[model samples]
Target: MYNLKFLLLAIFLYSSCKANISITSIDSLISVTDDQLYENNVDYITQNAEKILKFSELNNYEKGKLYGNFFLGVTARMHGDNENMVRYTFAAEKLAKEYDDKYVLAFIFLQKATIYKEAGLYNSALNFINQGLTVSNSIQQYEKRNCAKGKLLVYKAICMSYLNPEWKQILRINLEAMKLLEKAGKPFGYDYNYLNVASTYETLGELDKAEFFYRKSLKVSTGNLKGMGYCNLAHLAFLHGRFEDATNYANTSLDYQENNSNKRYRDIAEIYQLLTKIYTETGNTAAAKKSEKLFEYYHNKENYTNELFKKKLLIQLLAKAELNQKDFEMEVSKKSRNLLVFSVISMVLIICLGMIYMKQVKSNRKTIEKNNEQLSELSQQINNSFSEVLELAKSDDPAFIPRFKEVYPVFYQNLLSRYPDLTIAQIRFCCLLRLNFSTKEVAHYHRLTIKGVQTRKTRLRKQLNIPSDADLNLWMMNLG
Candidate 1:
């Protein structure tokens, strides 16, 4: 309970403020790599990119022009500024293709698919994901190819989930993607992949599994993805009729948008719609109106931008379909049937899951208590050992060294195993050093002068043939 409250508080604090990125120079801007920028909050990157675009003479350097546009597109995508995202992506694509940049083309294709996916164009998203995979396969760069392949599989899974909603099929695809990610050793956007799983489960009303993967997604999310996790959690709360919790979570999601400057317009609009419903249901009409007005603000913007994207995407798809109408029709029919069957199954599954939820909740509670109890026991053991070791360090008794060895027997044994030539007095001195005692402290404890302690340390260092530059105290401590 305490941990849950603390987690909530931390989420609140983190979502309530914008993170400030301090890149003040053109050199700093140029040095900001894609991975670094991706990990940053949206607004921070957006503003920094704008600064560089405005102040830096990017035209003077070709690489600068390429990176600048790519960075802008990334920030725009997170911002849900689809128009700008498409524009920047196309510009970058032209330049990349002109330069015969195979690697950058793979990344660009993935980014385009992501933007299309966010814009609710699943077919286009899948097409671009396929293009990305094609580029990935052609690349001989092992790590890059693997990473791109994993990402494409995950994206394909996402497109399939939205288009088909076949939970079991989606799960299988995600499993395949996970294996690829593990092999690649670079699992970028896997959090979103987990999120897609959670969303599928939630659609099926398998609340238990949905909650499990939502938490999993939350565990791995960074930047804008973290905000999306909070939004999903808010929706889950609403599903369970936990209005107050939903309101808190929705606001937290909004805070993340505001802080990160990503401000996903449609998501924010939906959150306000949620807030309005929550407020109205709880007899807060004034608050509901306020939320409704906020909803209107973002809803209008979203509709305008989304419509533009849809029209463009439809035209693009139509042009491609002229020579493959039969294939497109077949694909559409197959996916439509998949969605229909899944929805029917989901309705039946929800009823069954609803019946079992209470029992599962009780079982989960007991399991959590047992785990907490085990954790407490392990923590206590560690604390006790630490206390004994510290006490042994300060003691002046003749048995102090023996007590120390008793408390940390493995450390003592390791030292003797590694340095068998040391004499008894030297071993005793090494033990004192293990406690990180100063020369004066060791002298006072052992009833020897400081100079005597120093001489003993020097002699021990020579016997061990320790490098002069090496920290003697650190070396002794590490022996443990």
Candidate 2:
């Protein structure tokens, strides 16, 4: 497959501008995974990943670096170290599963099973291996099938040898292990199976046959199986009373083993015991005593280490339980936080709705008050207009003033509030004038001259304490 980053770079450099370069980079990175399509597309996926790692510097490419981790994990496990393998492969598995990269997930899970097997976690190894098998079978990928099946058989063999209760089960599994290894053409696995078979034979007290298989295991194993093959051969040699051969093989195993590795203390103590027994048998009393002292030192050292390891394992298990408890608490806290956030959200929504309801209610009340005020004002205006129509119809009638004086008797009383000396005749004239009638109309209504009506209006105004300069007509209109 072509490098997705390079294609994106071509587009970025050749494009007119750099406005959407980041978005383009993300698309290109996503397209890298899209380019691979198969259940076991680990190679193309890895190649795509290498392209980004080689070219891209940003953490955006990090999400695609899982395949690299997967490969490194495989290498680490092949070198007989499961801790680093677990570290790398777990990260890779998490990333692959998140992306729904089925092929990558399956492959990494298969490798994760291998790591578990090396770590002696048989159940975990089988579980991971089965998961891989399920996914691979669903996709019908033969490569994944071969990988999972081969590793699973080896895991079964180890589990049977170490933990199986039935002797027939152990032998059946070891034989199946050899056949599976032969089918897979894995020399390393075959040599490991041979060593296990030799141990089984040794347990059965078949020394010569055990020695034959142990030597065969020693011959077939690669450089990677250094300490294992030699250690087993040296143990067999010691059992057979071949002290010099035992020492030679022990020395070779020690040379290959690391100082602080899992094999060191056991190897040291076992070699010391073998030397002590050999020196004692050879009549070398001084050498025997020195070897015995060394044996005691290494033996005590191994016992102390075993106790320390058990303590550490206890601490790890306790720490794991504590971590699980913390996780449970954290999950509870998160749920509580979610519920709290929901409550706050609900409260805010309720308050906002309440405020909105109050505002609407206040607005409705204002509208109702305004409508009532308008109705009252309209009723008053209608009453006043009807009274003016009635007065206009009665303006020409002489009984109108008499009728008005009778109907509105408080007119004189109101006039007296402003002028205590206001006369009855002046009030009548004032009442006729207040109707806005013409002087001629007022004369006809009151049976008087137009000049007389005007004179009477002036007299009425003066009695009401009117100013000579003020407009009576405007004053009456304002009063009305």
Candidate 3:
């Protein structure tokens, strides 16, 4: 019994180890879908992605499930399976957000933009492209960030071409995308960029520039891209009335399309339509009818496919409306929080300024009070000196002149300095005037008649060079 138990325990341990290894291997396998997509192996990607999805579900591997759903959505888009593409893409988006995987989220945004572009919803396409760019910019890896941004910019240019009629702006956006891709060494969509720039040049009626970009597109293109290049060249030739060149170019486009594994029906229809126009213009009635029939056949098929896409789009739009509503609510909440924060900061700043202003006002009030007190004390001291000088002059004391000179030293010095020839009595007369005494009081203090005082004042005015209209007493008080 002990031996049997030991054998069962060993078997269980080995099984557990095998299961862990299998889960790890699935993680690595799911990562290769990106490479498969870049190589244009859509069929292989679909098969491998579906198997990854199954194993991930069985093992409950979240990251594996995310990549599997994303790549499947990419394949679904290539196959024109709009419904499944939307379903898978949204599923991957939900998982990516849960994992906080910015790289996968950026790609998902691009896929959404592409879906909207294919459905002719240019406004919505632009919205997703901008969102993808925002996420791409947040990526820490330089090459990955630039590569992701480059792809989004290409899509943005395509969407803008439909929504905006400004060809120059569209060309600028296309060139910016090419520059970013070149810097990253990715060259993700050079063919698309060249084709778009060529188309823009054609729209601007610059035939030479348009032909140069078309040739550039053909040089870097393969498969359907090469076919598209020939078709656009054919259309350009037709527009310029080169019937033979248009016919040859259109036939070459058709030949390339015939061998393209991933043929674009709309492009094929455009080539046939161009051929029909060429044959009709060149007077080849039989060939014109044949080309017209082929054009109608492919055009009808393209329309049917578009109709199916529109139907699927209607269903997706309903779901998208709900998602948009949620996004709007979150944005509103974010703005509310920001407003609350701003209000609090503003309140704090206002309070600080108010406190500073109040402190300055109090300081100024204290300084003004101190200055007023000092001025009042100085004025009282000057009044006391004036009283003492007047008392001595009123009593006719012998020391009155000397006392007056001490009380008003500057006035005494200015009078003596300007008039050294003045007598002692004249100097005493000036001292009484400097005290602001009335004419009668000055005559009384000097023991002379008012007329004698007036005569002394006239002589003093002449000695001082005072103006005729000036008051002598006033001038003496203001002398220094």
Model 1: CA > 4 A from native: 1-32, 37-88, 91-101, 114-121, 161-164, 178-188, 222-224, 241-243, 258-260, 277-297, 308-480
Tens digit of per-residue lDDT, candidate 2, span 1-480: 379988988897776355347445644764654434222244455565555444433444445465556555555555444445556676677777776666667667667666544434456556775687566555444543544455455555555555554655665666665665566454545566787777777777877877777778777764435566676777777777787887788678666654533455665666667767767776888988987787788788777554333333223323333454566556655655655566567885766655655565566557556445434443443445337434643554544544454334355346556666656666555565555667887787557888887787777666667788877656654453
Ranking by TM-score: 3, 1, 2
Pull out the clashing pairs in model 3.
Answer: none
Largest lDDT belongs to which candidate?
A: 3
Model 3 bad stretches (over 4 Å): 1-16, 258-263, 319-480
Write the residue-wise lDDT of candidate 1 on 198-238 in tens digits: 87778767888888887787887865666778888888898
Better of 2 and 3 by lDDT: 3
**lDDT of each residue in 141-166, candidate 3, tens digit only:** 88778778888888888888777467
Task: State how far residue 151 of model 1 sits from its true place (Å).
Answer: 2.7
Q: After superposition, how far is residue 35 of candidate 2 from its true place, in Å?
A: 22
**Candidate 1 — what's its lDDT?**
0.71
